[model samples]
Target: MSGTLALVPAAPGKRLGAAVLDWLAPVAILTVLLSFGFAGITSTRSAGLIIYDTSLLALLGSIGAGLALVYAFAVATVEGRSGNTIGNRLMGIRSADKDGYAPGLGAVFLRGIVTGAGILLAVLASVLVAVFKWFDAAPLILGPLLLLGTAWAAVVVVSSAWDRNGKLRGWHDRAAKTLVFDVVNGRNPVATGGIEGPYSFAPLDLPPVQHVASPVASRTPVVPGPVASETPVEPLPPAAHAVHLDTAAHPETAAHPDDAMDRTQVRAGVRQDAPEAVLRITLDDGRDFRLERTVLIGRNPAPAAGESQAQLLPVPDPGRTISKTHLHLLTDGTGLWVTDRHSTNGSAVTTPDGMRTALQPGVPAYVSPGTTVHFGDRTFNVGHA
Candidate 1:
């Protein structure tokens, strides 16, 4: 599980939507074929029984059927290689095997066989009418078959709704050992970022700001006055104490008068020049960065409000593996927090002990030193500088 990212299951609606789009070409072909076949049948109602052998309508129907066959093969080939079809891309979703890769030709063909059973049933009936039956299959039989086939196909599309494993696999998906994922909200195995359009983005969840009311009513004003000769001062803060020499408080230091520094100056210096801890980001691409302020890192990262002047680390990726604004990294004295910028392939953090957790888009998560952060195909190790 070195770089594994869990895929979120696609919704039933999205699955149905993709199926509808996938079915379009085949459906159109079938519709044209049936119409031509039916026309051929009606025309030869009073003609000789061998009319189909020379009928123009029968010839057109045969051509349409051939197109349908070709369409299926084309779709299977594309999906086998990319795990996406025309509809899957538009819906911002895809089908993949357990390792989140294209399931290959065998699985894709198997899936097509299972999911297309109903559609092919209607096509077969049309072929029988156009060829053997000489377009003589009754409308009563054809109508009901077509209707049943349509309904069955639709059922197959949304069958994942009834899946037992949290509705993650449809019947065809299970048969092919593939899984459908909501790429609009999760990692896209193919790329790190892109609005695979026709699908809405998930709503951004910003951290809620909690406002604490100041106790103004109970506060008292201090008057300007001369201090008593032996005025009692407030105890020094831990940081101030660490930076100062208080001989009066620690009599043992009185022997070294030369070591005495002005306590007030020391306290003031600590307050003004407190050191902050920053991070060193070491990329797998052999780039090392140690920036003090907020940073945006990606292929072509740009800053946002308040960070308009922030550091931009343009990753050297000719393949565009990372998003335009893949990650937002901020360092305070205490630690570092990273935010995923809604990249398509998503991002994740891996602990020193090898615990991997996916990062939610726009959500900040604290990372410890010696851990690795991954975005797209690139990975970077975080460490204290």
Candidate 2:
């Protein structure tokens, strides 16, 4: 590839945030159910005081244990099917295999089980010990088990950061052979070599032109013939000659119409013998949109009177962060060119070298493969098919 390979790792803070969100819903549901059940069991004593019984405490312990098990199973099932939990989807990150494809349901399930079962078991054990007052009787065993469980949980949380390859692989990821990537800027997993690499133009494979020379003995002696008078042709100007030489050297350039010449197409057409390049943009939500000659991007765009054309890409922006007509992408030959349409939040382009430049409205920017473009809070990367 023209640029070095860079894996887009989801920030540790975002990962933690997603995990918290994922757990919140189940915890809230369990807490509400337990609260209502406990209210019915508690007995009102003299002076409006409430008395709790051992049975209520035991029920609380059972509820906690049951919730833990349910949470683990639910998370695993969801993640296995979609490679994302509710939190991960909200944070624009997802799990994938090493090559960038979605880690199948089996892998995701295994990861969820490995990372969650131990922690849930520990929590369940802690609840049982606390409710039954067994910790005081077996402090040695209970204390050690609690500590080990806490340590395991902590290790899983930070394991991705500890990976030597910077692939953002946690213990669950390693166990399942999965990797977490920021969907916005991650490299395409299925593309050949991940991205299109730099290549030089070579001569087309054509049969060698054969020139047959006349044998000297077979040549006829020159016989004078009547000369025919005609107007002498003038030589072409220097500029015209130069243009001719250029067209001859790059035959693909001659095929494109004059009006079709653009920076993106010109560069892409340089290698005429190479396969036609395709442009693909992958969204943070695991959606891939292939760009045609013209692409319109925005949250939504209303159709005006007498305008029958529908928007090319009408993305749903629940936060109202993206503009109605944020930007436009055009396929210039094999490459892509993006132009901001005076968006309210503006837009930015991140080059392959990690440098970001704010885009000016109406000015087109060539987006190379592996480069990312950000529009408001959303982002997409340009890649080859």
Candidate 3:
């Protein structure tokens, strides 16, 4: 871990919410695509004997529009919820302001717009190029839009990779002054800290106030009383013998200093600071694991070429290279999930049959986010950064 301090903008495990939202996006897109495809096919069939080429083009355009809407919704929702879109999730990417937070809807919308514009421009450019090729004359004017779209896409990608956090600062996060925590361990640091030590107060005595007399009054000394005949004072009785106290007399007091310390401080300290384990997931091979930090949830090793703020961390101690031992983090458009990337350990899952059932390595298990993941002697969890 780098010694440089990584400011924790928000409590840890915030990205899990956005991950859930991202997971839902693909399902939503799939629904939209299938519906649109079916509808387009039906409409074209109903208008049979018409210009087949134009009809096909119209259907293609409709599909393109549907795709654009999916992109817009996916990006907008993720940006709104967490400051990045589904593309960011799938690509292990994110976008945020200089300071991380959930960027406002406006920033999300603006990012969506920028993304949409780029796609639109790309499509337009491709069409223009096709036209120019067909005409064999002066190239179409849409070439510039194509170039602009390409440039915009490149810029966004680069900005994300190069930014302080692995994020593309969109209008929403920027306007809202929020940033994104790209890789989250899914455990709440505040909760962790609370489990460790919460703010508390105790009472202690303060010094008493002082008093003074008037200088004149103090200056005048009183005359001593007339001397009286001195009588020999009788010696006091022999000092009382030391008394032993019974245990019952001091039930509240401890028998030893260490015991006192343990009662007063050790017990209180345990109540103050202690490590908390969140969730435990069992793999197919009867091996149970705990969540940890600095984990890679996505399969991809890199972001787009121009992704500016995209941060990359090398896999530390790729342990136990089992047959089905790879792992990936995935967002189900609502929450985050840690999944086995088809490792040879057989990705065992604890089944209701009270036995470990081997699942496909690529399958996912709902390991708690921000939770420390413990695997054999190794542990993975997110910390500051």
The regions of model 3 sitting more than 4 angstroms off are 1-5, 8-53, 84-87, 90-99, 122-144, 160-178, 184-385
Candidate 3 residue lDDT tens string, 1-385: 1111222232222333343455356435543553454344322234454221234334654575667567657666656655446544554434444423344567666654554466566555545533333322313444466467555644543343444643334332354454444334221111121111111111123233233342333455454444444544354334412112444466675276444333321221235654553333332223333334323422133433453333332222222222122355543322336555533222333333344444455566653333443322233442211
The clash count for each model shown is 1, 1, 67
Model 2 stretches with alpha carbons more than 4 Å out: 1-7, 25-53, 127-151, 187-385
Q: Model 1: runs farther than 4 Å from truth?
A: 1-6, 42-54, 134-136, 190-385
**TM-scores of the models, in the order given:** 0.47, 0.39, 0.31
Q: Candidate 1 on 1-385: residue-level lDDT in tens?
A: 1123434678899988888898787777768766765664433343544433436556776787788779878888888767789999888888776545566779988877787777678767766765565344457667888788787767877899998888878888888888778888776655432322111221234233333332332357454444344534557788766645574678765556533332222222234665677677777855567766688998799887778878898875433457788999987745678999977568999999999999999899998788899887779988765
Q: What TM-score does structure 2 among the candidates reach?
A: 0.39
lDDT of residue 146 for candidate 3: 46
- Find the candidate with the highest lDDT and give its number: 1
Error of 3 at 232 (Å): 74
